[model samples]
Target: MPSDTLNQFLNDNLNELKEQGLYNEIDVVEGANGPRIQIDGRDLVNLSSNNYLGLATDERLKEVAKDAVDSHGVGAGAVRTINGTLDLHVQLENKIAEFKGTEAAIAYQSGFNCNMAAISAVMDKNDAILSDALNHASIIDGCRLSKAKIIPFEHSDMDDLRQKAKEAKESGQYNKIMIITDGVFSMDGDVAKLPEIVEIAKEFDLITYVDDAHGSGVLGKGAGTVKHFGLQNEIDFQMGTLSKAIGVVGGYVAGKQNLIDWLKVRSRPFLFSTSLTPADVSATTKAIDLLMESTELQDRMWENGDYLKKGLKELGFDIGNSETPITPCIIGDEKTTQQFSKRLNEEGVYAKSIVFPTVPKGTGRVRNMPTAAHTKEMLDEALTIYEKVGKEMNII
Candidate 1:
């Protein structure tokens, strides 16, 4: 029995979303979301996962995870502050610090929680956050939780950031000012101008926060966007994830020892949530070790990306400006974008359409993430399906 007010609120919003074609119907993947996947009894080439390095299915990670299960059983019993912090957790944090070239690092349950914990823990009512307009939803929520004045600068617009940062700094309205941005804009897949951002931060005495969720294991030879730009020491907070490239699940913040120390004690998620399970932590450590050992997987990922992007372009698709392996075929209308994705699925490719709310209206696209696991043959096959679908949908 629900209240009339509650029912009305739900019905109104549901109707609005449904009318706008924004109500998403999720499709379940029957197996791993590899280069090829199974959904609804059909085999489709998956182009939507963030597993750039393809380590998610690597034998080494499996070995590590199994070994962890044998040694440590399953879950962490309590929050990290109580009995959840195992030796594996410490080792994983240390491995992260080594991988990120930082003095220390702290792990979180998820990359989303990293933002939720880090931002609110440091910046408060007296502080202000200068955020990039196209930053992730986690970043937006984090800023709100901090109770700080969130000033949005145009995407990658350093000039505007400088102007606003100066205004915020001089107003005497805030005690601390922080400039936060995604290391790689996920929608556009463009790398952030970290060198210019660091300069601006220095000029304004602003704390720098870089959430490198997409950049880790993709850029900087798998270190991250900061290291890719050779500004590791300049950036105050370097946030990364174990889920994407690492092929595991978790996030980390690496920086000076004092920052890590403060976050460990104060970051809300770290203080309240259970630490990562033994298997996840173990597999993540193996992933980092593999990344550090060689760039073979990274090279393969880029090779596949280039091959796929070239084929998409040749097929008369409008692949957007993406410097990374990420490819987006721009389709102008939301309905058309959804149709394109449905056609792709029917034709055996699994690239999903991204429409409004994720990007501006009329900027609908089918975003593809090509990974190291894809072979030349697989990509060519997928490209052929894309071409067939494009012709059928008259998208090209």
Candidate 2:
């Protein structure tokens, strides 16, 4: 029933992607995604997941989720604007607000949804958004959805941002100007210069938005990059994901009560989409509780990250300038980078190759995500495999 034109387009593009080595073949994880994973019945040292705090598989979270399922059933039954808003959802929002040190918070189904909802909710055709060059795809897409004039400044170039802000403000072309950036650049693992950004926003009177998807539960003692720099009050939108470090399936924006109230009323996703299930809300609340209660997991996660980074760096791999636990082993050529990841898989490592569209054209890399669940022995084994493979491929 497919049209010939559509089939031709699909085939041509699929062939082009495969020929150019840009095609990403997703691997199936056979069990719970933890420090060690099983793919095709082969055990792998997992370094590709966003479960930063190891809470995804935590027994406490599992128990709470199961209890929620028993009590509330599986689904929310309808959209939030109807009768889908549950007490569990309210609790999760309140917990997120408390954990992030914000006056209030509103939850979304996912982090990507949060960006899509939040950005377009506040910004429109009359507004302008100053975005970082290397922000996440979701942020880029969200900005585009807002129909605002998107002015991209060089990655972390404060001077470029200030110049753009000055120009945008002085031109009087926009009714409102907003500066948006990732709290941590996910691909290269560099922390955003929030202190300088806040200063610029204050000077230009630009609304500040920080998408802290990667920074939440990783920095600021598990608070996030905003609280890491003590700028929770300064940033207008402190957006983050529960799926990353919080180890749940949702996202949220924590800020002033007025902003939260406005988002609840205006954000389309929160209004129209089916609400998060009781299990997810309950488990996410418990994750935030755990994060607020102790930093022991985060401490372990840091130690593991340092260990992996040191091992790779000592092996002469270009481990880019990462300020956090996310590590990217840069291997310039796309095919070679893919080959390196393929070899790693064969050797029991699961660090995936990030190429072209994910990063720059020639800066292909194998991004490693170390978590609190990874044992030192597992890392040592992975390092040994890296040594063997790097030598085999002359990548070292």
Candidate 3:
């Protein structure tokens, strides 16, 4: 049997989370995650997915992935350094470099692993990192893993960042300093002030890293946030994921050739973990090709996002300031937020509640992600459901 102390700790914490409505009860999706999904034998409008471009179910990518499976088999048999690096992997990395307008790029198994590998590989105990307070959990974990002096600045506050950067540089206690931020904050959908951040980094001689996981294929005509601000040449690291915008399952870091070379040899995940499978690599390459071919999907996504935001705003619900397609309906109370999401699900909408630890306490919300695949009819139906639920609960 497991230790009683461990069992007690688990029981106590689980009970506390359940009582406060903080315990997440994950619902199983019956099919591909798209604009609509099935759960418990019922179909619901899905506004909780990160499939912004709707390419996850694209026929072109599917066909390519199938071809890759036939040609290259199911898996990359070994770690990248130990021969798992196939021709498909090289092709994907090249395509990523082309898409990101970087000298070179390296792919990873996941966005979280990319952060974990990249940050710790470069920065160390002797270094300092000026991180945004609202950065993702992955970025926080990465910084912690680096064992760097992490000084968090206020979110999007350039002055705060400048002060922190100046202090870190002037302290002369660190061998190196890096400024890391999410190009687009996923929670509230606010874009980072990259231009200002770049200016500060330059003044302080700090390395710049932009995790554009949410911004890729959604901004800068699909090149990403660095290109969105025309800072491709200025930013040192342009990190992104193939999973979200590209509608595939991988992550990557795009930078100068030297940086890519270093990460190839030094990044733990790339060195020790198996490379991406043929299907994922090929599918991701196709997705990037589609993104670069035209901006039709990206444009439609913005239109749908604007339409949804306008509808939510007109209904008098406190949809927070979201610059992107991610819309958050603030409910204030944690249990109320969870209840609101449950009602949304019951009424055929599948948005999820995000509460404490994700966002600050007292700001619990139901995050609605309107993808490009959602037709106007779907949006209208979702809005109608929102209206009914909002009025019933007096949320409006």
Decreasing lDDT order of the candidates: 2, 3, 1
How do the residues 280-321 of candidate 2 rate in per-residue lDDT, one tens digit apiece? 999999999999999999999999999999999999899999
lDDT score at residue 110, model 1, on the 0-100 scale:
96
Give TM-scores for every candidate, taking all chains together and pairing residue i with residue i.
0.98, 0.99, 0.99
lDDT by candidate, in order shown: 0.92, 0.95, 0.94
Q: Show model 2 residue runs off by greater than 4 Å.
A: none
Better of 1 and 3 by lDDT: 3
In model 2, which residue pairs have backbone atoms overlapping below 3 Å?
Answer: none
Model 1 is weakest, by summed lDDT over 10 consecutive residues, at: 16-25
Task: Flag regions of model 3 displaced more than 4 Å.
Answer: none
Model 1 misplacement above 4 A: none
Which digits, one per residue and each the tens of the lDDT, describe model 3 over residues 76-184?
A: 9999998899999999999999988999999999999989999999999999999999999999999999999999999999999999998999989999999999999
Which has the better TM-score: candidate 1, or candidate 2?
A: 2
lDDT of 3: 0.94
